[model samples]
Each structure stands twice: as C-alpha cells, then as structure tokens.
Target: MNATVVYELAGSYFGGTSSRPVPAKLVVADDRLRVIAGDDLLAGPLPLAEIVVSSRLGNTPRMLRFADGASFETAGNATVDRLLAGQGRRHGLVHRLESSLRYVLVGLLVTIAFVWGGVRYGIPALAEATAFALPEAASRQIGEGVLELLDDDLLFPSELTAEEQARLRQRFVPMIAASGLPIRLEFRKAARELGANAFALPSGTVVFTDQLVKLAEHDEELLGVLAHEIGHIDRRHGLRQVLQSSALGLLTMTVTGDVSSVSSLIAAIPAILTQLGYSRDFEYEADDFAAELMANHRIDAAQLGTMLMRLEDALRKCPEVERCADPERGWTTYLSTHPPTTERLQRLTKR
Candidate 1:
C-alpha cells in the first residue's frame, strides 16, 4: 500500500509507473503512508512491516523472492516501502515532485511572456526589412499614394508645378541617395496646413509639405527632418509599421469581413501612420547620417539642432497645431521609437 504521508517519511518505496524506463526520484513518505493517487486511494496503510524488500518496476519485470520466499509484482504504480523511504517534508514525494513541477510551469510561463513581447515589437522590424528590399520606384509610388490619401484639401495646397517639384527633388534626392535609402522625393506645391512635416511611405517615397519647405531657413534644416524620415525608411520602420497595421486589418477582416471592418481599418489609419516612429537607435543613426551629409556639404549640424529646438518650442506654444506633440514627456512608446533630441544635438556639437 502506497500513501503520501505529510509527517515523517522514513523507510518507504515510492515511484511512478513507466512504460519503458523507471523514473529516478522515487521514494515513500511516513511510517503509515497515506497517498493521494489520481482520484482514488490505493491498497493500504495495513501493517505491511512483513513486507520485506519492495522492488520498483524497470523495463524488465522481476518478482523479488524474499528470505521467506514471498514474492509480489513490482508492476504496480508505486510500492509502499518506496513511498515511505522519504525522510523529511522537504525531501518527501509531495514536496519534491510538486515543487519541481510548479517551478517548471513557472519557467514555461516566463518564456512565453518573453516570446510574446518580442513578437509584438519585432513584427514591424520584419516588415521594414521586407520593404527595404523593394525597388526604389515601387517605394516612391507607395509614398505618392499615401501623400494623396492623407493630404486633404485643408492640409495640402491644390497642386505643384513640374519645375518646382524638380527643384525640391534636386535638393532632396542626392541626400536620400547618400544616406543609402533608395527613396524619391515628392514636394507639395503649397505647404500643407499641417505645418512643417515630412514623412516616408512603404514604397520608397518621401514627401515634404510646401509649408515645411518654406519653414526651413537652410537646406540642412530640411535635410535634418528628411534624414530622420529617411532613417525610418532605411530601417524599414515605416514599412514594417504599415505591414503590421495591414496585418491587423487582415486579422480583423478575417474575423468580421464586413463594412465595419473596412471602416475600422480606415479609421485607424492615422494612428497606424503616426505610430510608426523610429527607435532611439534608428533616430540616432538618421541624425548621424544627416550630420555627415551636412558636414560633407559644409552645412551646419547646429542648424539641424536649431530646427529641432524650434519644433520643440513651436509644439509647446502651439500645442493645438500639432496632433502628436507630447511636451517634455519621457519614455513614451512613441518617444522610445525615436532618438532624443538632446543626444542628437550633443553629438552634433561634439562633432
């Protein structure tokens, strides 16, 4: 009779049943062992002291013949002597087995949590990598389409002329190329009402609102912003974000495939676009890239720094003008995705 006794575990045999190989940590608990096995308790705390030499099952079943010639099958779940062999509470079957099992389960849960978090942040990176591999022409087309989609009449002026567009391209294209991004530049004829914004699309296109163009005192200031956006492009940050959003859309559409799903995805477009900010590392890389471009072109890195300060100041005074300005906030999901302005300025100054 095998029973798990909570008190003193002395001389008992305890072990689990195995089809092929026997388990190592098998032992018993207490003098008169009371075990809980499955739903039903087993054969006895009966005075089994006469039971001499209890043996556990191995691959081969051997009936032990005692000094008295009495033999019993070791083929059962656990022998009583084995269960009783456990010495103390810490070493007992319940303590050893249950505690080890609990720890194993906990370890599994922690691993799962780590994996989930990595996937959540990693999907965008995966998407970006894929986007970077795309041809420059395809990327530009995507940027153009996004600009058309986002720039409402209130945000973008009516139209830009071919000559003006060429001028903007001339200013931006070489810089983008030098930054190792296969990106094309598109300019809005009239400044966007949205004030001083430039962004990239999945297809290798970057757009600067006319207002953004007018706001820059020097080409380097524009390059600073453009470089940041290019950083987003080179790292495939924007493409990854767009892909992640689209993947979410696909999941929603799979679940509900209705007009509501379409509307929901459309409604989420702004958040999706705005949410695709670069990480601190990416931001720094872009800043350095811009700085190098400026240095090579003999442009002042401090001017880029100045532009940032100006943008920061503008956001503070005209908070209502910018939708995504979190004044003096720290460690935001958004901010975490972007490099800090202070570091960029410091690095530039040091250079």
Candidate 2:
C-alpha cells in the first residue's frame, strides 16, 4: 500500500525573500511533485529531473533545490525518502560523508592508519630494496662523498707513526680480506672537536681515527672495531642508511621523471650519521659480524664488548654536546643514534 506524502510549504514572502508557513500541502507522486494552497495549484506537477535532492542519514530534514535556485525543505525525511527513491539519479556520497557521523569517523581513522603504516614500514622496505639494487660504483661514490664531508669538518691526516699503522694494517687486512670482501683501511686523526668513533663508508672504506686507535687497550680491541665496521660495508648498511634518510625526496623524484645525482644523496650522509643513528638491527648485525670474525681468527670476541664499554666512556667525556649527554654542558643524547652500549656489550659477550 502506497501513502501520499504531503509536506507543508513555507512559502517565500513577496514571492522570493524570507519564508513563512503558508496553508499549503505538497503532494509527491512517482513522476512529479504537486502543491496546493488555498484552492490554488502552486508551481508544479514539476518533473523530478529539474529537482536536486539531498538528505542526511537520520531524522534530519531533506532539502531540495529547483532549477531556478529556489529551494524547499521537508521535516521527518519520509517524504524526501520517497522522492529520492523515484529520482533516476542520486547524490549523497557527498551528503553521507558530511551528514553521517559514523561513516565520517570511520573514514578518518582508516586514513590515519594507512598513512602511519606507509611511513613506518612501507617506505623503509622500499628504500632498502632500492638501495640494495643500486650498482657498487654508485655506493662507492656515496662513500667518497661522505668521506669528503667528514674530511671537511671532522677529520685530518692520521698522526700515528707509519710503522705502527703499517703493522696494524698488515695484520688486519689479511684477516679481513679472507672473507672475500674488498675493504680499504685508512687512518685519520680526528680533530679534538670530535671523539673516538669509527664508521664504514659505502665504498668499503673503514676509516680509523687515531683517537680510536689510542683508545684501544689491545690490538685485538682495535681489530674488533675494524671487523664491526667491515660488517657495515659487507652488508651495504651505509648506503641503505643514506637512501632511507632521503627516501621521500628521492622517491618523489623517481616518480616525477627527475632522477638526480647520487652526489646529492652522499652529501646528506654527514647529517644523517650525526643526527639519525642507524637502526638498532643494523647495529646488532654489525656486532654479530665482528663476533664471528673474531671467532674465525682465534681472537676472543669479548675484546669487542670491552672496547664498546670504553668507547661509551670516551664519548661521554667528549666536548661535543650533540654526541654526548651532559646537561650541565648542554649536551644531550637527542642526536646519538648508536644502540645503548650495555645492549651491545651484552650481545657481544654472550658467548
């Protein structure tokens, strides 16, 4: 059984201004909307084609717009529902998004989750995959560029007696070379402004600071540090770190037909290393590599753990505030990226 839906008319005063409820009844049928006021037929048997319908999901009134920009409203929505049901076209992806509180909230939550996941997981995985696929020459270029930055601001020629440097290199080189990895061992004197820190470049260059060499109580301890840095190069961790830092910009360029120079990626490495520390897993993996290298060479792996502890103390005493945690001296660990020394020590000494 079909019932006629009659909506009250709030007709405009003086034909087109403010509205006042008139004594009128609006009758809606399958094809048209009709209205009668004081025995006068007001406006149409108007076709649904020239009418636009909009409504909320609940009890709120629906508004209709006529071709001439005049409008009408109905309370209780039942009449609007019937009229919309017969209209050949519908609108309210816009209407539902704006008017339905539940759907709007759900959409907002889903969008946030998607963006968070992309940043946390998707971007890193893509950056790693892309980084690993790059040519070895490109990586070396990146390493050289980073070394250039370090040389410019943080490092100078090593002051170690050549005889001492040659002796250590001769022993360390043969041991590391046996692993079938190509690595260049270079020594430098870190400016007093920096502390004892050793990092591998993507080009397979493992730079040793004279301070780090002097900090090592045993040659084995220095070898342990060298092995750890070799692990970084062997796994291409340096290049990956560089790639990950500038991923969004690099990815944007790749997609937009503006692939630029690898030099730009290299230039950013100094900031990335100083400010953003490597991921914890990379640190652990490098630690594992050093341990394995020590075991293979008949050297005690505990030497690495002992050296890590001392390195922590050395960094603590450093004058650079960005690399240490000294509240009285304005140094904070905010820029420190290395995994906690206690954790690395425990892992290295486990066996």
Candidate 3:
C-alpha cells in the first residue's frame, strides 16, 4: 500500500484521554487499512469492516474509528477524498450539498428562498388550513390558556354593568348563531393601559376592553369593531399566528428528528397570545370582512372606517413609553403590522 495521509492520533488512556497528537502514516489497500509510526505499528492491516466514518458536515475534523477504540482525526482532504472515491460509503445529502462552491452558493440561495416561503406563505397557509381543521376541543383549550395569561398579565375586572355587556353582545347574536360555533363574549377594563382594543381568541371568544367601548362614539362603531374581531375569529387568526411563530422551531425539530419539541410549542400557547402579531394582509382581510359584513346587514360600512380612524387617533395619543403595559406589549397597537388606517378609509370611500 502506498503512503496515504498523516494524522495527529490520540485516544482514551486509563481514566482520562490524551490531548496530544503523534505523527503517523496511514495506508489503505486491498480492502485493508494499516498505520505506521517511526518504529511501531498502531492500527492496521485491518479489514475495512472494522472502520467507522464520521459525517463530513460542519467544520469538525473527520474521524475514522475502529471497533477496537482506535481512532484518527484529520482535516480529511486526502483520506476522505480517497475513501469517497473508493466507493465504500454512500454520498450523503449534506456531502452532495458541500460538493462544490457553486453548490454551496446555489444551495444557500435555495435554502433562503425555501425558509422565506415557508415563513411568509407556506407556514401561514398551513396554519390557516390546520386552524379550521383542528378539533373544537383544541381551540377551546388554547383559548382558555390565553385568557388565563391575560388575566395574570394584562386584563383587569370589567367595570361595565351587566346590562351594558348584554346589550353589546346582542348585536352579534345572529352572526354568532349563523356561524354555528360556540362564540362567547367578555369585557375587561384596560386599566388606563392598552388603551382601546379588541381581539379574538382561538375559541371564538371576543374580548372588548372598557376603554375600547368608551372610545366608541356610537353603537355603529362598536359594531364595526365587533365585526372586525369576528373576522379574526372566523379566519382563526389567533391559532394561525401561534403556528406561524412556532414554524422555525417545528422545522428544526423535524430536521433533527426530535419529536418532543412540539410539546414546547403547545405549552407556549399562552405566551404566543401576547404575540398575535398579524401580517398586514391579515389586517386587510379582516378589514374587508368587516366591510362586507356591514354592507350585507344593511349597516353603513363607512362606520368601520370611521371607527378605525378614531382608534388610530386614540392610539397615536397614547405615548410610546406607556404602551409597555399591554401583555401584547403594544404589538396590536401602533407597533402592529395592521394595514394603515388610511387604507381602510380609502376602501370604504370606494364602497
């Protein structure tokens, strides 16, 4: 056998392992490997059946291990290249990916594009479909968890009278009944924080903050807000948001074959509630929903536009530093990606 590659060889000794590298020569021929040092034989004239190779991923030095616990580590340019050409091991996906500079560049671009598509379109689409497909029991559990978190961190006791609550909920009775889903309504005081806002829970619960109710100049405006929130519930935006937020973690788990990572995402549902940051398109969809619903009910859709404009003004009045009080940390506030209020108003004008 011709001399192959030199490696710094070290292995476990007694209670601890040596960190030193000894110069040696390795050769492979006739389906056998041999190692030689100055005046000694180390590992070889052994059949290839005893050798175990390491993956070529990352920058870690490639290692060749023998059944007898003998091993060699090298930068792997010579040995791996030679062994790969010899055809003992199959080329791995990662190896193929690392085969050339062009592959690396092209793979990187494709990877970026793939991940961006997943995050931007694929994850959300899957979540949207899955949200509606999910059993009612799951959404109920998720909604309960979210409400508990809000109670602990953001919501205060409602100050509105029972009559006001009942009256406000009355308007949505037909819509809720038509949807055939168990939609519940709740109210809470905003505690001079979070200002005026309404959001939908995964279980078809629509919550109205006291400030939000007070902010409305008329029943029509409140109806507009309710319609908007119902739009979110109808689209399962809360659940979709949760799924989207956990997409990367889920992908990592899938790639690494770690199935348990899903448990963390499930357990973190409440945490995701405060992060229900809808995309701009989601906001537009919700706005369109509110408009169409209003128009179908013979109610002026412009009231929603007016209401959004008023809410925008109110949100702008609230100082930036003060927005930290919301459990969502003003995520649904001005910091949100909801389409500009002007856009909604423009659409209403066209209507």
Candidate 4:
C-alpha cells in the first residue's frame, strides 16, 4: 500500500448558484481532494488532476473548481502551494515573476526600450514604406482639393503678369522635363498673408507665391527652389509627413479593428501638411537634392543661399501694416517651412 500524505485548508464553498458561501474545509490526501462543511461532505474526494486550481495572485484568494460546478475559495496560498507540490503539479508562475525585484526592473527596462525603439525608428520606417507603396493615383487623390482649400482660406490669385509668368515657365521647361515626373508649376499671391513662400503638394504640384518670384534676383534662385520642391514630390516626403503624423491614430485603429476612422484622418491631411510643415530631416534631404540638381545644370547652388538670406531679411522687414495675417501659422514664409538659413547656407555654399 502507498504511504498517505494529507493536508487541510479552511475556506468558503459556493454551490455554484448561491450568492452566499458556507464555511468549508478542503482536504487533500495522496493525490485525492475533497471539500467538507462540519459533518457534511459538500464535494468530491476526486483525483487532484480532476480539480482546477487558480494561479496564485498576490495575497488574493485562490479558487479550486470541481466538475460538479461547485468551488472552494481560500486565502491559504502557502498551503495550496504545498498541496500542489505534494501532487507534483506546477503553480504560481505569475507570482514567482512578480515577487522578484530583479525581474520587475528587467521588465521595466525592456518596456522602455521597446517604446523608444518604436518611436525613434520603427514608426518612421513603416511610414516610409507605406508612403512608397501607395499608388500615384492615391497621392493625387490626397493632394486633390488641397490647393482649392488653401485658395479658399489662405492664398489668392497670382498678381504676376501673363508675360512674366510665361517667361518663368519657359525657363522651367527643361528642368521640369528633366524631372521625368508629371510636374506642374503654379503661382499665387499671398503678399500680406504668406509674405514669400513656396510649397509642394503630394500630387507633384509646386506652388510659388508671387512675393517669392519677385524676391528672387536671378532665375537660378527660382530654379533652385523649384528643384527643392521637385525633391519633395519625387521622394513623396509630403505623404510621408502626413503618415508619420497620423501614425498613432493609425496604430490605434488597427489594434481596435476600427479602420472606418481612416477616412476622417485622410480628410485632415491637407490641414496637417499646411500647418505642421515638413520635418527637419525632410528639409535637409530636399536641400541636398536641390544642390545636386543645380550642379547638374551648371547653375551656382550658392544662389539658393543668397535667395534664402534675402527672403529672411524681407520677412523680417515686413511693414507693420502688411505683416503676415497669421504670424503663428508660420506657413506664411519660406523660411518658416525650411530650415534655418545659416545651416542651409553652409551646405549649399560649400557646393
């Protein structure tokens, strides 16, 4: 005959239908289990494997469930551990992890590293991949109505004469053709509201404010600006900026299985692009592209630097009466969207 090992625990028993529990004792002997109340046998003397045991969670009560829908709840966690040990059963995996300070610190460090890596590298890389994978028609759709929205709210009809506009277009013909993308140039007047600015839309439309055109001393400077905007289109930087800005929202929607909100996000893209502008890295990339384009055309890249410095001076000297209508938007001037003039000048002048 096998040696008998017995253990008992005090707890409460629920008959599976009642809100009230009765005082009960759980008896474990030689791999068999039973629940009793004083003189009454409330539940089975069944095999230990037939009873389900809840994992230990801090000092909370653990529950043992039986096949007949009755359960015994107890706070005798140590005794339950011993009972399980005697039966050669594994238990308290969560409790073992939680009780160790070293494990807690390691978990915290791992969480921090994961969050940092996602924000720093993972999100941007995913945004870039998504931007590139999207079709040209989708890019055009994103940019559609954007210029009209800006025209209705911020920009005005170009005041430059037809002759002058045609002349600039004639000069831009070679550069635009060289780009090998469907590129179009537009001129707008935002003298009082935007001062002098140039921006690119995702659909390969590049807008040059009339103030910017008049501010340039040489055609090379204007071409340089055009090259920069082309860079934005070729690399889909505008779309990438929109994607990166809305990453958290996209992630939340994906996690919750609610992609219906994506349309609302897409609708907000025009506002986000105009208001937030491109990131510093995007600006640097475009500047490098412009410098290389100018070199290929044998135009001095330093002319871009000259134009940038002049634009800065002109914006600063805006007559009090004609100052930008929304100074906070900073979308009013090229300098506002582009990087610091000194940093750009250093790179452009070197080439």
Best by lDDT: 4
**lDDT, candidate 3, at 196:** 86
Off by over 4 Å in 4: 1-46, 50-94, 191-193, 251-278, 318-338
lDDT by residue (tens digit), candidate 3, 150-236 = 888789989999998888888778756765567788899865556688888987788899998888889888887877887887777
lDDT of each: 0.56, 0.72, 0.71, 0.81
Tell me the deviation in Å of residue 276 in model 3: 7.7
lDDT of 1 by residue, 1-351 (tens): 866544322222233332232222212344443333344443244333434433332322333222334233344333433443542212334344435767668878987676445445565566666766776555555555566666555345525577766776788767766777567676664432456667667666777777666667777788777766776676665555556667655644554456356687675553344344434555676677667677776777787898887766654565464545564464443434445567678987986
- List the RMSD of every prediction in angstroms: 12.1, 10.8, 7.5, 7.6
RMSD of 4: 7.6
lDDT of 3: 0.71
Candidate 2: regions farther than 4 A off? 1-88, 92-98, 248-278, 319-335
Residue 80 lDDT, candidate 4, scale 0-100: 90
Query: Which is the winner by lDDT between candidate 3 and candidate 4?
Result: 4
- All candidates' TM-scores? 0.52, 0.65, 0.70, 0.70
Q: Give per-residue lDDT, candidate 2, residue 219.
A: 92
TM-score of 1: 0.52
